[model samples]
Target: DTAVSQTPKYLVTQMGNDKSIKCEQNLGHDTMYWYKQDSKKFLKIMFSYNNKELIINETVPNRFSPKSPDKAHLNLHINSLELGDSAVYFCASSQASGGHYGYTFGSGTRLTVV
Candidate 1:
């Protein structure tokens, strides 16, 4: 089984459309996160959730929302998607206490807004 997985690996939509991407991890981790990689390949964390509590990254836009329905799942919803929102969104999970350990990431969801 995949340690982490995301749905709809590719998404193409028009500007101003709304879309959601779903993610799940079977690593039994308590912390889950959403990251966005720009065309330049700069990766930044957009949101983090620990045991269903929200931990927003100040830099993220309000249009992006993350929901953790359970410990193993984190879903991202973007409203009024813009062309700037186009990027590869990655879902990752890691143990809450292991700072030295790296996160297990999903393949990524590529979203393109035309």
Candidate 2:
């Protein structure tokens, strides 16, 4: 019954550790996306997947990789996490309505690197 859920709601790790955050949605949406909110509260589109195909936005770090097993799930794997990588990662989904409709976001996973 959760519309969207992300595990490891809060993560605190060393500067060079690797981490993975899992996300799943049961809303039966056609598209899912990952957005990173910076310290300044600027939300940026990181990666998007639909139908097992990827549609990335701007240039995200190579260390950040998104995997979508199916339309219902998209997981993010980060390698060599840095202090700058510490941010609130949100997983969202929207019905395929040409991006006009709003998206439903998960509670969010907060990652803190020390």
Candidate 3:
């Protein structure tokens, strides 16, 4: 079983359009997160959810939203996609209630805006 999976490994779209990417994990984890890796390779946390509750990271943009239906799934929705949104989105998960444990990330979903 795949521990974590993200769809549309690559996505190209025009600015002003809305798009979404799906993610799922089979690791029986209770927490999931969305991270953005910009061209410079800086990894930034967008949102984190544990048991469907929001744990927003202030560094992220308002246009980005993360939704988790359960512990095993987290999806990202981007509104009014902009050139600045051109980056790789990674879905990650870790054991619930732990901080020392590292997170497992998906290969990545590269979003290109034109």
Models 1 onward score TM values of 0.95, 0.95, 0.94
Provide the RMSD of all predictions against the true structure, rounded to 1 decimal.
1.0, 1.1, 1.2
Better of 2 and 3 by lDDT: 2
lDDT of 1 at 32: 92
Error in Å for residue 1 of model 1: 0.5
Residues 1-114 of candidate 3: C-alpha lDDT, one tens digit per residue: 678999989999999999999999999888888988999999988889887888766577779878788878899999999998999999998887756789999889999999
- Residue by residue across 49-110, what tens digits does model 2's lDDT show? 88668976569989999999999999999999999998999999988867688899999999
- In angstroms, what RMSD does candidate 2 have relative to the true structure? 1.1
Candidate 2 — what's its lDDT? 0.92
Which stretches in model 3 have alpha-carbon errors above 4 Å? none
Per residue, candidate 1 scores C-alpha lDDT tens digits across 3-105 of: 9999989999999999999999999999999999999999999899998988766487899988999999999999999999999999999898857788999
lDDT (CA) for every model shown? Answer: 0.93, 0.92, 0.90
The TM-score between candidate 3 and the true structure equals 0.94
Model 1, residue pairs in steric clash = none
Candidate 3 deviation (Cα RMSD)? 1.2
